[model samples]
Target: MKQPLKVAIVHDYLNQMGGAERVVGVLHRMFPEAPIYTTIADRRKLLPELQGADIRTTWMQSIPGILRRFKHFFWLYPFGVRSMDLRGYDLVISSSSAYAKGITVKGDTRHICYCHTPMRFAWDFATYMEGNEASPVLKAAARLLIKPLRWWDRATSARVHQLVANSTIVQERIQQHYGRSAPVIYPPVNVSRFEVSKEPPGDYLLVVSRLVSYKRIDLAVEACTRMGKRLIVIGDGPDRDRLKRLAGPTVQFLGRLPDGEVVRYMQHCEAFLFPGLEDFGITPLEINACGRPVVAYRGGGALDTVIPQVNGLFFSEQTVESLEHALRSLTHYAWDSAQIRKHAEQFSEEVFIRNLASLIEGQLSSRNPAARPAVPALAHKKKGAVL
Candidate 1:
C-alpha cells in the first residue's frame, strides 16, 4: 500500500483567538494528524479545540515577553517564519494574515495559503495604524518598516502553489497587491451552536466585537446614544475606555462573556449591529443563525453574506448618522426568523470543510497524478463519515 501523504498546517501565530484562529481550528479538525507550526502559541489564549493538537512553535516562542507584546517585535516575524523546517511534509497549508505564508518549503511540497488578507500593516499602513494606541516612537518605527514589509509580503505570495481568499474583497486585494488571483472561500461559522429564539426579540440593539478603533464600535455607541436606543456592547480591547466615555446612559458594556451567554444575547437582540469594514465578519452570521437581523456597514465581507432585506440591512456610509438611519429603517421591515436562520446555514462549518477538502484534493491530484489524497474526500462521504 502507498504511504499516506504527509500534511502540515502553518499559521502566523496562535497567541490570540479570532476568526483567523477559528479557521485554523477547522483546518486542524480536517487533518487531525497534521502538526500546526507557528511563530508562537500562547497556551492560555488557545481555543479549547486546539489545546490538544500537535502545535510546534519556532524559536520566537522562547523570546522573553513575546506572548504579551508580539506586535512590538513585528520586524522579527518574517525571520521567525523562515526558521520553520517543513522539509518532509508533502503538503503544507498556511492559514495566514501575515508572515505564515512566507515559510520556506521544499520545492516538491505543495504549499497552499488560505489568506485571510495580505498583511494589513504592510499593504494598508494608515488603516492598520488608525485605531491602534502604539506610542509615537513605535508608530514612527512601524511606518518606516511598512515599505520593506510590503516588498516582503508581495515576494512571499509567489511562494505559495495555490491561494484561497476568505472573501471577495480579499480576493481583489490579492490581485491588486500581489498580481495573483485567488479563489474565494467564505469562512465558516458554527451555525449549529445557535438556535432561533422562541422568545420575541428584545428592544435593544447588540454589538459583539473587539472594542477596537478600526472596528468603528464608536458609531454604534454614538448612534444608539443619539437615538436613545438601548445598545449592549460585548468584548473588550484597548479602545474600551474611549468608547465608554462616548457612550450614553442607554449603552451598556458587557465586555467579554462566555460563548453561551453571547449566544443568548444574539438570540434575544432586536438586531445585531456591525459597524466595521471587516475582510469577512463571522459574528453577523452567528446572530443571523439565532434568527436576528444585522445592521451593518455596506462594504467589505458584509457584501458577501448580508442580503439587504433578506438577512440584514446595510448603511452605505461608515458614519454614525448612516448606521442610525439603517437602525431606524430596520423597524419598518417585516423580518422572518426562519428565513434569516436559513440564510446563515449556507456558511456553516460543514460546507466550508467540504469545499476546502475538494480544493486540496484537486491540487494534490494535479501536482502528481499517482499521488495519494492529501485531504480526505469529505464532499463525497456520507454524513458523519469524516467530521
Candidate 2:
C-alpha cells in the first residue's frame, strides 16, 4: 500500500487580514483537502472556510476579539507560528505576507513557501517607528524587538525549500532584505467577475480597500474635499470610523461592500483610486479587469501593475496634493478597454493556478523515485531569483 501525500498549509495571523487572505483563499481552492495552520483565526468575521475547515491554531486562538484588541499581541506571531504541529505531513506549503513561512517542519518533509513580503513591520520599520518614542520603556521594547525580528525573518526564510513571490517587487525585497530569492507567481485576479461597462464618465471616483493607516485612503478623501470632486470610499477596518469623521461632504463611506457590488461600481466609476504602498495589489487588478482606469500610489507593486496614461495613473506620493494632481491630470488621458483587459489577463486566477500547479507538480515529480531508499538529496532551488 502507498501513502497519500499529507500536506499542511500554514499562514500568519488571520486577524487584521487583507490581500494575504485573498491569496490564501485561492490557495484553499487549489488544495481543498489540506489542513490549514495559522497563529489564530478571528471568528468575529472571516471567510467561512477558515472557521469551518479543519484548522490548527496557536496560543492567539484562545484570545477573543483578536481584531479590535490585539495591538500589543503582534509580537506573538513569530512564536505563535512556531506552535503549529507539522510532524507527519509530507509537504508543507506556507502562504505568507508575513511570518507564516517560519513554521518548523519535520526533517523529512519538503517545504514550499509563497511569500508576500519578508514581514512588513520588521523590514519596513521606518513606517511604524515615526512618533513612537512616547516613553523610555516603549522605546526600549522596540529596540529589543527590532534586531530579534530581523534575525527571526532571515533565519526562518532559509528553512524554506522553495519560494514563490506574488510580485517582482516583493521578490527583490526578499533578496535584499532576507538574502533569499523567489520566483514570481502573480496573485490571482478573477477577470470573469468584472464586465466592461460602456457607460460614460460617472459622478465620483471610487476607492475600495481596508481602511488601514498605511492604506493612506485619507489622502484621497482630503483630495476630493480640496478639489471638490465626489469620492466613494468602500471597505471597512480600524480606520473606517475615524476616516468617516474626517471626510468632507464629497466623500461617501460604504463600509465593507460585497465583491459583486464593488465590481459593478468599478465598471461605472470615473476611476478607481488606490493610495497604499502595496506589495502586490489585487484590488487594482480587479478594478482594471472591470474596465475602469486606476489612480494608484506610485511605488512598490503599482510600479509593476500600472502603466502611466494607460490602465492607470500614478501619484508621486501619499499626499492629497499628489493625488489631486493625478486626478486633475486624468482628464487629458485616453484608454482602450481591450488593452486594459489584456494587461490584467496576465495575472488572472487561471494563470496563477496553472503556474502554481506546475511548480508544485514539477517539484514533486523530481522528488519521486520508483525504487528508492537510495536517492541523493533533492534540492528545490529557485528558477529565476526566487524570493
Which stretch of 10 consecutive residues in model 1 shows the poorest summed lDDT? 371-380
**Candidate 1, residue 80: CA error in Å?**
0.8
Per-residue lDDT value at 77 in model 1: 95
Q: State the displacement of the C-alpha of residue 123, model 2, in Å, after optimal TM-score superposition.
A: 2.1
Pull out the clashing pairs in model 1: 235-255
TM-score of every model versus the real structure? 0.96, 0.85
- lDDT, candidate 1, residue 157? 94
Model 2 is weakest, by summed lDDT over 10 consecutive residues, at 371-380
lDDT, candidate 1, at 55: 98
* Model 1 spans > 4 angstroms off: 130-133, 371-380, 383-387
Clashing pairs in 2: 181-386, 181-387, 182-386, 182-387, 183-386
